[model samples]
Target: MSARYWALIIFIGSIWGTSFLFNAVLIRELGPITVAAGRVTIAALVSWLLFFALRKPLPRDPMLYLKLGLLGVFSYAVPFTLFPISQAHIPSGLAAIINALLPVVTVLVSHYWPGGEKIKRHKAAGVVAGFTGAALLASPSLAAGNEHGELWAIAVCFAAVMLYAITLNVARSFKAIEPTTIATIAISGAALTSVPVALWVEGVPHIERIETWAAWIAIGVFCTALAFQLMYRLLPRVGTTNFASNTFVTPVVAVLLGVSLLGESIRPIHLLGMGVVFLGLLLIDGRILKIWRKPVSGTEVVSPR
Candidate 1:
């Protein structure tokens, strides 16, 4: 990967990683559904204002809007809702760690994406390592309290990852449009689609807690809109493989956020697990470790049909 790609990776990883901290803080204050509603609402409004301010016209094609809706529902709306619900059942740290499966899911989904990255053995091994790290990350939580609940919520986390996998691949076709515009459409759709449920479930949120408001604002502006826009901008330039590598790094950053900012304790096992996971990510990345693994010659490319 290029240096620019590496920089982008760290930037994206930090933003996404800290999202767990945001979720944990806000969920405590506002509850899951309400927190999600507030997040999407805030993101939609900010993006819309930015969209209008930039004087960017909406897509002339209505079909694009439809596509955006599908992408939004799958990518942001469903996963956004399900994640918090799962977090309600599971711990936020565990939820974030379980989300470590994203690269594996992304690789699996890429196989079906036309003109996308090739899935190879190293990638598979890396996915295994990532899960190992994730398992280590969640092991204490899983072993100690409410194993069934944790397991159940982890299942939902997997579903959310699948949705994310689909959305990342779908964004490839949206290259004709700016990432910011696509983000605006997606968040707007999510806000509108989720409003009824939000109203029915939570009814006008109080938004009294400063921590809750901070989390909501961060999610709306940084995680949802800015992060999506950044991901979109980075993807075309760096290619999806490098962009997807953020999946490997985000958990580490999340763990750091939990420990440092939130004052959560970090166990030795967690560190050991992170080391193994990093090794796995190296296996997946095809940059550094591929050299030692030696090169495979005579590559063939087939178009997705």
Candidate 2:
């Protein structure tokens, strides 16, 4: 890959990573349903407008609609709901640790997909280690106050990350469909689902305040619309392996914004948890030093062209 490509990935990771800060701010004044609803609703509206301007046809196949709807529900609606819920109790860093399992979960999910990446011993080890870090990170939040209740929220974060992993694989099916189509279908469907829930639960998102409005805008534009566009552009280049590496970058970004912008604090355990999680992901991906030292064998050696 070119340096430009690598830089793009890092940039995208950073933008998406900062979403935790945006989400935390928004959730302060809005209910989970309202925040989640606004993101997909606004993203859907914007994407569909773009598609309309381009005269793009919506996917005709029923299966595409089904995938889009499912994608919208799990990837957008549920996870959007989860982040704010978890942030209500736990810090974003802890939520990030639980999310760090994304790569490991993606690897595990790929195994069941037809002709997907074959699971190997190294990947298996990575998955186990990564999951361990996730468990450790969740511990503090659970232990602090009504541990079980806090744990339930953290569990929602876990389920959201798992769903994200599934979406990473499932999104390949959108190759024939326009990227906008997939995003449009998913976001629109999610928006519709969220509307009723938001109305009933949150009642229109605290419209009178400035910061509340800012939070809503950030969720809708920055977190939802812009982030998906960036993801679409980069995913094909990075492929899944390195693409999953974005999770490693996201938490650091999330932590910085959480602490600096949201006035959230960090402790030694959180830093230690970050280290342990990074170590686990490194282990999961395998030791670079060992792989570098080994010489290419069999028919794979480079030949003079």
Candidate 3:
């Protein structure tokens, strides 16, 4: 990748990492449902504004909306709500740590799904190592006997990652649609899904704090809306394999922000688990190994496709 692409990926990763920090702030005054609802709502609005500004043509197919609606519910509403609920029990850093498993899990899903991507030896090993790290991260909470409901929260976060993996696989079926349109419609569907649920359950949020409002807007605009735009821009040029590098950057940024800004403590186990997960991600990425494989007898080493 060029310097410009690298810069863009890192910037997107940093912005995405701050989402957990913003969620922590919003959850102080907002219920999980309200937080989720507000986030998708703002993101949807901003996305539609961009959609119009870009002068993109709308899809006339009704079935497309149906598919996008399902994407919204799975990709945004449920997982978005679940994260806040989990963050209530666990630190934002821990949430991000578990959420980092998306790429690994997606690899696993792709291997099994019909006509999906096949796993190579490195990716298979990556799947094992990734789940092993997940187990390590969860061991402390599980051994603590769920006294603080951290175990359940950890499970919920894992569930969210699984949903994300599945959504990613499903989204691949939308090859004919523009990425921005898919994002816009999906976010709009999430807004439509969550707002009613929030109103019904949370009974309308009343926020007076300036910081809370700022945090909400930050998450919606930067984390959700802008992040999607960046991903769509980079995906075509870099391909999914390179784009997956963002996963590694997110957890590190989340942990740093969680510790420094949110005043959360990180355990040694968290660091160890994160390191193991990074190892697995590196294996899947194959970049370091590619560098290590030197040419022999003047024959160039070629990467596996």
Candidate 4:
């Protein structure tokens, strides 16, 4: 990867990593539905503005619009709402760590889908190790006797991750569509879906502090809108397999922010679980194992998609 791609990876990772912190702060003042709705609405507006600025035409096909709308519901609205609700019961770091299971989940889901990658021995091992790590991470909450409801929160986070994996497959299926167009339509659909839910569940939200408003804007602009744009741009150059490394970086940043900014405690078990999960991710990616194999000619590897 070039320096610019490297910079994009770091920038996107950092912005997305901080998204958990932003959600934590926003959920303090607003309901999870409200926060999720506001962020998507803001992101849609920003994305549309960029679409116009770039002179890109919106998709005219009704079927495409319908697909994007469904993507919005599954990919954006549902997962966005779930994450914040989960964060209410769990620390942001734990929530972020759970997100690291995306690749494992994706691998498992892909196994059943037609034209998907077959699960090899290494990937099977990765799946087992990854789930073990997840179990280890959630064991403490399970041992808490359901009083704090951390297990439920962990389950919700896993659901969100599953949605993310599904969305990745959905996005990959639309190879003919431009990323920006998909982003704009999906975000708009998410905004449309979330607004009514927010109003029904939380009513209209009031902003009292400038900091809260700033954090809200940051999430929409930097984390959602700009991050999507960067990913779309970088995907062609780096390929999805290389780009997927951002997953490794994002959780680390989230953990750090949770520890330093939010003052959340991290037990030794959490560290061990994170290490195991990362090792599983590395195995699934086939990079470390490739060290003993013959070198390939191309810069790109075929992604599971």
Candidate 5:
């Protein structure tokens, strides 16, 4: 990959990483449902504008719309709300560290899918390590035995990440759809699901603070909308293998932003947990092992022309 591609990948990761910050900020002022609803609403509007500007038509199949609608609810609406709810209790940086488990969970879930990627020996070990790290992160609350809210919040974050992994697995069926179209439809559906619930549960979302507006706009536009646009553009050029690097970069940026800018403090145990989780991710990625593996005597190395 070129320098431009590397920069773009990092930029996308950085943008996504700040979403934790935005959630922490927004959750202070708004209900979790309202915060999520507002985000998807803004993103949905932007997506519609792009849909028209780019001259992309909606999918013709009714079944596809049904699928996308379900995805919207599960993928965006539920998890978006859950993240804010979780952040209300836990530090944004810790939440970000937990969020890193998404890909690992995906690997575990996809193994059960028909014709999905089978679990290799390294992948199995990686999954075990990933869960072990998660247990480490959860240990403080578990040991305390009284901080149920914090423990529950951690579980909720894991649940949200699991939803994302499930959504990704299901979204593989959308190979026939344009990435932009899928996003527009899914986000639009998310808005539709979340808006009514927000209105019912949270009322009209009165915002008196300017900071709230700023945070909401940043999350909606940059984190949700523009990030989706950037990802689709880069995926074809960089390939999914390269794009997965964002998983590593995002949490690091999130941790830094949470500590420095947000004035959040983390324990040494949290750092150790994060390190273990990352080690698990590296194992799952298999790049290090591949680089070190020596070829068998009969094996052939095929060079690209």
Candidate 6:
């Protein structure tokens, strides 16, 4: 990748990483449903405007719309709501650390898909390590004498990641669709779905704080809209494997932002848990381990998919 590609990846990571903090801020003033709805509505509007500005036509296939709607529900609406609700109870950093399990979960879920890569010994070990780390991370919240229901919050985060994994599988089926079109339609569907839910669950939103509204706007424009646009542009240049590696960078940025900007503190055990989870992700990716195990002979080596 060129320096510009690297810069884009880092920029995307930073934007997405800061999203947790934005969600945390917005959830304090608005209900989770409202926060999710507002963000997606703004994002959808921006996406559609861009779609038209670029002279792109909407997909004519009804089946594609159906798939995109499902993608919207699973990928955007549900997880977006869950993250804020979860962060209401847990620190944004902890929420971000828990999100590191996404690739691990994806690996496990993909094993069951037809023509998908089966879990090898290393991946199985990775799954075990990853889940163990999640357990370790959640243990403090589950311990006796703890008043808050942090376990439930962690479970909600896990559920969100599971939905994300399902979305990835759904996305694979839409390989013919342009990335921007998929994003625009899916986000529009999310807006359509979320608005009703938000209205029913939270009623009309009333924002008195400029900072809160600013945070909400930032999450919608920067995190959701701009990040997706950059991702679509960068993916073709960087390739899927390299683009997916943004997962490794996002959590680190989220953790830093949460601690420094949000004044969040992570326990020592949680840090250890994060380390173990990252190790599992590295194992799942298989490149680093493969490189270390390569022979001294100057021969080409192929890493596992």
| Index of the highest-lDDT prediction | 3
lDDT of 6 by residue, 156-177 (tens): 9999989988788768877778
lDDT for each candidate structure: 0.76, 0.76, 0.90, 0.88, 0.88, 0.87
Q: Which candidate would rank higher by TM-score, 1 or 2? A: 2
Which stretch of 10 consecutive residues in model 1 shows the poorest summed lDDT?
A: 292-301
Candidate 3 achieves a global lDDT of 0.90
lDDT for model 1: 0.76
In the range 99-200, model 3's lDDT, one tens digit per residue, is: 888889999999999999999998988889899999889888888888999989999999999999999999888877898899999999999989999999
Per-residue lDDT for 1-305 in model 4, tens only? 78888888878878889999898888888899999898999999999999999999877899999889889888998999999999999889889889988998999988877777788988888889899899889888777787899899999999999999878877878878998998989989999999998999889898897878998999999889999888888888998767777888888898899899988877788778888888788888887777746455445787896
Pairs clashing in candidate 2?
Answer: 126-284
Per-model TM against the reference: 0.84, 0.87, 0.95, 0.93, 0.93, 0.93
> What TM-score would you give candidate 1 relative to the actual structure?
0.84
How well does candidate 4 match the true structure in TM-score terms?
Answer: 0.93
Query: Where does candidate 6 clash, by residue pair?
Result: none
Residue runs of model 6 more than 4 Å from their true location after superposition = 295-305
The CA lDDT at 275 in model 1 is 70
| lDDT tens readout by residue for model 2, 1-305 | 77887787777678777778777877777888888888888888887887798788867688877778888988899898888888887777667766777777777898998867877877777777766766666667667765557677778888888889887777777776767777778888888888888898878655667877776777687668777866776777776556666778888888888888878887776677677767767766665536755764323766899
lDDT of 3 at 196: 99
Off by over 4 Å in 1: 1-5, 89-91, 112-118, 132-148, 266-273, 293-305
Candidate 5 Cα errors over 4 Å, as ranges: 294-305
Model 3 residue runs over 4 Å out of place are 295-305
